[model samples]
Target: MAALIDAIDVKRKTTFELEGVPYYCLDADISSPTARGGQTLVRLRMRNMLTRAVFDKTFKASDKFKEPDLQTIPATYLYSDGDGSYFLDQESFETLQLGEAMVDDALELMVEGLAIQIDLFNGNPIGLTLPAQVELAVRSTEPGVKGDTASGGVTKAAVMETGLEIRVPFFIKEGERLKVTTETREFAGRA
Candidate 1:
């Protein structure tokens, strides 16, 4: 049997199970009553682990949720094909496949041999948790001419090896490795 957590305890990045499906909390807000003896509401922005859907719902502060059987393990990017993207679990040496919907925009940040974390629910792969930053090589971009850096905050479009296009600084050139922040999908710095 799993332990239960009260709604008031739920916060950002919390994982709990409702019914039989696992849910990840993106954000949580608690609203207290202005008058006496009023019920408190815990509004949460949650994402469905299996379906990758995001929605908002409100629950009473006293509501209880069962902690989910979720685990994250290190994995290495293997390849992608007609079926979906593949990864090799570093801990167990097992091969895992995540569907297109599950991979989604994350594919743009992945490259062969990249290290990442895979989220598992009830011993089955549910979704992927990307690293905060990743190193990607620029596949193509306009040439950076001399003195371009004189204009501060200038940027140009660049395509990464994994097909992600991002606005890089004007001094960035083709074939240079860059640090990219996964959450915002923006250029971080030189790698």
Candidate 2:
């Protein structure tokens, strides 16, 4: 049996030789935060070896990862007509369509030909991560009433370029750029 030791036994930034292979100790922890749709969810925080960027992401523990080498591909949004989503791989120039289940609420924020980064596992697309903030055109909304600012920050419904209606501060008008929270579809502020 291989020797087992507490994860803390390794010193930070210290390299160790194991089985003729050199390895650096990295701090990481996995936790099942919650269960959704009958899947065990896990959150992980890791640093990118190349960029040194710290990233935290959640995933289903049941999903098998072949290796730590996860690939990020630039894909252009082809189209999504409420049924499914399609994209074009910029490097391979191949077209791939993902089911609605895979795309999830991301379909609500997509604009045709929009470039997004997709994470792939074993050549299969797993999840999509979008920009923190995206400027979208407001398609429709009620005209702001004069003196409406007196209210205690009440919001009104506004439709976006994607036809998804969300509540925004009364000052927002049609055709204006508004920043939205991609997760909750809430209005962050006027762009």
Candidate 3:
């Protein structure tokens, strides 16, 4: 049987179908009645899971949206070819090619052989779910200025194995592995 959902139960980071199109629920908000007799409404900010188009919408409590038919498959990150990132699905052994725009900056947090979640909508690759943190090897960075103390408030720019640059404490050096936050692309700490 097909899945159905009430608008009130919709949550962020999940996809729900409305008007027969699947949308990623980025955020949901409920409005308090301004006047004593005013009707309450719910607002949603959503992105088209396939086309990447985003928009805001208002809905009533009784609105029904189909739960998106999605499957989460485990995949291993392969290599990138400048224009796209590739992944090998564990179950099917099929390579999924996602364009740079679709992959966005998430690739920075992924390295070869990393386990990742691929979201398939109607059996087509739609998006990814990444871990909160990843460990990346530092490729290069300027030598810390002489005498920068461990407790001092100074940071140096370092390039990672994935070619993304981020500021790290002066104590960081080339050839070290550091944990990075996937969402903000910031240095977390040594791995």
Candidate 4:
């Protein structure tokens, strides 16, 4: 028997199968029962684990759902080739390649030797989970003019080692390490 999940726990990043299709919940808008004992329901926004298409759904009461056969594996980032980025599974010692389209915005955070969690469905790579924040070195940025603090600490465009560009304080410069939030691709602070 498969593990089951309560409807309320079905939020962002939660995986389950609906009508035999695997999906990851992106968000849920839950409406509680009214004073008159109105029906409670939860509206869900979810994505297809395979096709990456998004859809909306609604669940009532404590709808129990069978958890999909999804597995999380530790992998090491290798390098991006013409087709996609390469990774090595730490446990199985096998290499896997995820297509560029599959990685999406994660390409901005990927670096050689970075540890990541890969989501696998039926033994196939489906998605990735990166560290909440990562330290990446600034590859290049325009030099800040002296006394530029007068601009109320204006931000300038800087490129990271992985080629992701972000607005950073002028005081930052080339060859500096910056802590960046992977989810938003925003600069958190100096590393």
Candidate 5:
């Protein structure tokens, strides 16, 4: 039997069907807003339960949903090679490889052997969400000193080992590990 859920409960484990296809949408919002001009808009964050694809859509507040069955599974990050990204099923001990296209925006935050939770439907992997923070090493950057007041306060452009560039504090150096926020890629602190 299919499960039913309200739009407000979308963030949790819930399901709904659209055109006969089941989908699990997470961290979604469905609400009506009153604007300055007295106009109203409905916003939504939806993920395809089958494909694990996410998208935002706006609709009239009058619309409603019919629920579907939602399931959850635990997965772990194995490794990534030129071939593709791989994950190990915690419960089944099965490993699966996902193409670059499947990872989408989450690719930029990946690190070797990092474990993360994945949303799936009917045994197909859909979306990859990473931790809020991650630590990485600096690969290259110009040197900076404590008393260097020549460039504003104190900042340096450092390239992470992953090849992503970030503006770090003046004291950071090559090979030094630093904490970074996955959402903004901003430097958090020295690790």
Candidate 6:
């Protein structure tokens, strides 16, 4: 049997089940009552594991939730086809094909052989979690002018091998490897 967690204990990344559906906590905020002996409230921004829907709701601090049966397994990007994207589970060596809606924006950051974690509910793959940063090879960019820096904070558009376009320093050029933040899709630094 899974354990029950109080609403007041919910935090970012917490996973719990409500009414037989699993939800992941994206953010949580607690409000203290202004008056004495008043009810405390916990507001949470939650995402549905099955439908990917997100919403915010408030619950009493005493509310309880059952921990869902969830697990994250290491996987490697295998390839993509007309059907969907494929991944190889490191532990069981099984191939998983996720639908377009499931892969979504994460596909733009993926490269062949990239290591990532896949969330599994019960026994089925549910979500993809990318690393905070990823190294990608620059596919193309314009040449940097010698005095480009004179203007200060000069940046140029660059395309990565995976077709993700992002702004990079003027000095960045084709074939160079660069670190990029997955959340913001911004250039971090040279790989």
- Using all chains and alpha carbons, the TM-scores for the candidates as numbered come to 0.92, 0.61, 0.87, 0.84, 0.71, 0.91
Candidate 6: residue pairs that collide: none
Per-candidate local distance difference test: 0.94, 0.66, 0.87, 0.89, 0.71, 0.94
| Cα lDDT tens digits for candidate 3, 71-104 | 9999999999977899999998999988887787
| Candidate 6, superposed: residue stretches over 4 Å from native | 31-38
Residue-wise lDDT of candidate 5 within 45-144, one digit each (tens)? 6667556678776655444566643445667777777987898877888987777777765666667776677766556776566778888889999988
| Candidates 2 and 4 compared by lDDT, better number | 4
For residues 72-136, what per-residue lDDT tens digits would candidate 6 score against the true structure?
Answer: 99999999999999999999999998888889888889999999999888988888999999999
* Descending-lDDT candidate ranking: 6, 1, 4, 3, 5, 2
User: lDDT (0-100) at residue 23 of candidate 2?
Assistant: 35
Candidate 4's C-alpha lDDT?
0.89
In model 4, pairs of residues that clash are none
Would you list the clashing residue pairs of candidate 1? none
True-structure lDDT of candidate 2: 0.66
lDDT of 1 by residue, 1-191 (tens): 89999999999999999989999999999999999999999999999999988999999999999999999999999999999999999998989999998888899999999999998999988889899999999999998778878878889999999999999998887889999999999999999
Which has the better lDDT: candidate 1, or candidate 3? 1
Off-target runs (Cα >4 Å) in candidate 5 are: 6-15, 20-72, 149-153
CA displacement after TM-score superposition, residue 170 of candidate 4 (Å): 1.0
- Alpha-carbon RMSD, candidate 1: 1.6
TM-score (C-alpha, index-matched) for candidate 5: 0.71
With candidate 6 superimposed using the best TM-score fit, by how many Å does residue 17's alpha carbon deviate from the native? 1.0
